[model samples]
Target: MNKLLEVKDLNISFHTFAGEVQAIRGVNFDLYEGETLAIVGESGSGKSVTTKSIMQLLSANSEIKSGEILFNDRDIVKAPEKEMQKIRGKDISMIFQDPMTSLNPTMTIGNQIMEPLLKHRKLNKTEAKHRAIELLNLVGIPKPQLRIKQYPHQFSGGMRQRVVIAIALACAPKVLIADEPTTALDVTIQGQILDLMKDLQKRIETSIIFITHDLGVVANVADRVAVMYGGKIIEVGTVDEIFYNPQHPYTWGLISSMPSLDTTEEELYVIPGTPPDLLHPPKGDAFAPRNPYAMKIDLEEEPPMLKVSDTHYAATWLLHPNAPKVDPPLAVKERWNKFQKQVGSLNGGK
Candidate 1:
């Protein structure tokens, strides 16, 4: 697949009264055409910030210290406001996490969806409304014609989200960034929303960047996974590679913490310690404080992303050739084995 977007050496900071908060620290990743790339991380891990930067949606206090966000061979970070305006909704669109906050309560559903069509597509009132109803129906809202006339409060939470997705997809953007789109919904609704997105991906052929900490959701939707920690991508690989053959200790922790059907234990595993404070960032590996297998080098120097395979790489000293071979935690190992078997069984042992 061709590269749709490439974020290289991206660094972002927020100038605050306290100090400069280093939100994104030299982050790099690629989003391929027609692929769902899931950015998994704890809150404040720079997942949303990174995607937000792609859209140039940073706040007044936020600053892009340095980086290049290449989208379709154009560097968005250097693009003028006029150029960005042309690209925002037409070329790329984002579905925010909360529909209540994203959608205006005063406006009718049809008008909200038509807003982009009018602004970006230069459609007339009648044409935009016609497109809005089509979008509503496209996202699986029954009786869209009738529903379009109503306000956001008239629809259920799931329906509200569907409306939001419709608005995001109104212009047929090449890339869609969903920032924890399912975080506010219930489990059953979450499944429906995810299924809807995957269905849309196939029909629209648009690349999706899904940002969330839910590994379960990642398994359901993602083609590739990028694990982020301390404002950096600690590991990145295909779904099978990250889940079955994780290299970074942080990746192992995340996989092990995911709820498994094979596990009978009542208590779930949780990674210890909070993420590092970015104001006074650590000198070495950011995850070293919580990593049980961390060595002296992890405290003194940062580990480069060591290639584990053609498609897999992890930033951890443990992946170094000279580093002593150490097994992942017992719980993690067991969970990986169970997941591998589960996947194999599902694939008919092929």
Candidate 2:
């Protein structure tokens, strides 16, 4: 697949009265054409920051320390405001976490969707309005022509989210970044939203960067997954690689913590300790403190993202040639085995 966006050694920091907090540290990943790349991590893991940095939507105090956000062979990190304006909502678009906050309650839904078309697509009122209605229907909104005249307050939570998606897809953006778009919805609505996005991606052939803390959601939509910890991408691989052949301890913890359908265990697993404070970032592996299999090297030095396969890589001392091999929790192992068996059965033993 062709690479749509490449983020290389990206570093970002936020200035607070306390000090400069390192929000993203040398994070690297690529978004391929027409594929969904899910960035999975706990809060403050820099998943949102990384994506926001790509969009140039970081807060005023945020600083870009280094790295490149290469999109379509152009560096977005250094692009001027005018250039970013042209790119945003046109070439690339983002659906924020909250539909309530993302939409303008004062504006009609139709106008909200049309705003981008007028600004970026240079469509006149009549043309933009027609396209907006088309987008409204495209995102599964009912009576788009009538609903477009309604304010955001008039829509239900699920409907409002659909409106936000319509707005994001207004200009037929090549890349769509969804930052936990379903976090605020209930399970059923969440599933609907995800299904909607997957359907839209297929129809539009848009590359997506899906940011979420839920491993379960990643399974549904992601072709590839990047696991973040302490402002760093600790693991990057295809979804199956991360799920069934995870190499990093952090990855193991994340997978194990997720509820498994086939597991017989009564107790749910949880990773120990909280994420490290980034204001005074740890010198060693940020996840070392919480890692049960942490070796002395984990506490003394940071590990590089070493290759595990052609498409899989992980940052962990455990993957070092000299380190002892430690098995993941029984739950994780069981889940991996189940996934492998399912794959084997699907292939009819090849």
Candidate 3:
């Protein structure tokens, strides 16, 4: 697969009354053509901020300290606003979490979807209207012709999101960045949206960067996963590798916290301690305070990312040659074993 987008050593900071908050710290990742990469992390993990930087959508107070975002072999960071305007929707599109906020309340849904086509393709009113209805139908929105003329308020939450997806696909963008796209919908609706996205990807072959805190969602949609913590990508690998043989303590915590179909545990496991403050950043690893298996070196120095395999890398002392080998918690081990058994049973008793 060819590389569609590359983010190299990206760092971002926000100027605040208290001090500068270092949000993204040398984050690096790649998105290949027709592949889905999911960025998973906690609320303040800078997952959203990193992707927003790619689109040049950061607030005035936010600054890119270092990095290059290369799209189609061109550096987007240095691209002028006028050029970015042409690329934003035509080459790359974004779908925000809240469809209500993204769509204009006064404008009809048809007009909203048609705007991009008109601007990018220079289609006439009749042509744009016909394309708008087709887009709605493509996203699995029922009664496309009638729904196109309705206002944003007329659509339900899930339908509104469908509209958002329709508008995103208006120009047949090569890449789409969906930031918590299903957060506002119910579980059934969420599943519907995920299925719709998968179907669209199959037909269009668009590279997707899906940003979410939900591990469950990632399991269903992601080809690869990047676990973020304290404004950095601490671990990255294929979805199965990250789920089955996770190396980072933070990644372990996230997987253990996921509700299992086989486990009937009364209480869900939660990671202890809060994320480190960025204003006065930690001298060593930010996750050391919450890590039960933290070594002395974890508090004294930050561990560099160690390669476990060609496709898997983690920033944790556990993978270091000199560090002592310590297994994950007993509960985590038990959960893994049970999950393995279930998988074995499902795959023709392998």
Candidate 4:
């Protein structure tokens, strides 16, 4: 449980014609060695923006107003471009959602993977070429020798993703950020990719930051989960805690919305209302507008993150001592029970 990456009070904003969009507001989390942490939220919830800021990959209009991103005890936020270049692929790497866009269309797969080895490992042409084919094989690509010579367009979507993963693992980074890595694939392919990532993680012992909106995806790959909303984390806890004893309304909605694997539900539950606009952000709790359990205080004041357990924390008035106790929807409770049974079975009924 060694700490690999720490993001403290990280804030990111964008300068647009209309106004400054506060994309990430005081978000905080830590990734431990060989652990997978999933950041789950709806689109525009700052899931991608927060992680992108850590890599200094924000767009030209976006600005890092404040906060510290400490990687390996070094303040990466303050590091120069040259220093970051060395760290990007050597110590930390990212796999974007669309592999086709991320990969160079004109470059051969072999040359693309070899680029990192040549830049970071200082490998000669022959050495880099040999390692490139080895990486392709490592990612389960068939006929690595012939495949390496082909262009990206020659591969299928799933195969292209394997190439993207190969590039990310080429440098053997300590931390890997996967931003919706399996979003564009079919369900079966998505499961295979997720399993592959887990298997690779076990072999390499690398910490991963998995960003996605799919709770089902988180269930398989994540050790811990951070529930985000309106540019802030509303709940942070272990996978079991968040799944079994969720405290935030947002977290409850997300769990209830998950397509049940055990039950026959015709339609999936969707959270009501839309995410709040960041231009003129709410003065109080940003989620108040969409929260079904909102109280009078919820519209006038924001709640601080309350400690529910040693490792679990949630930002909601429902956890306050003076507030009346409430229960989540029946559907959510049912899902929690099913999830518990699954976990128990996996742990040999412990």
Worst 10 residues of 4 by lDDT: 259-268
Best-to-worst lDDT order: 1, 4, 3, 2
Worst 10 residues of 3 by lDDT: 338-347
Model 2 per-residue lDDT at 347:
44
Best by TM-score: 4
Provide the overall lDDT of each model, using Cα atoms, as 2-decimal numbers. Answer: 0.93, 0.90, 0.91, 0.92
- lDDT for model 2: 0.90
The list of candidate 4 runs beyond 4 A from truth reads 261-267, 336-350
Candidate 3: list runs displaced more than 4 Å.
261-266, 333-350
Q: What's model 4's overall lDDT?
A: 0.92
Candidate 1 local accuracy as lDDT? 0.93
lDDT of 2 at 205: 90
Candidate 2 or 4, higher lDDT?
4
The TM-score obtained by model 4 is 0.95
Quote the RMSD, in angstroms, for model 4: 2.4
Q: Which is the better candidate, 1 or 3, if ranked by lDDT?
A: 1
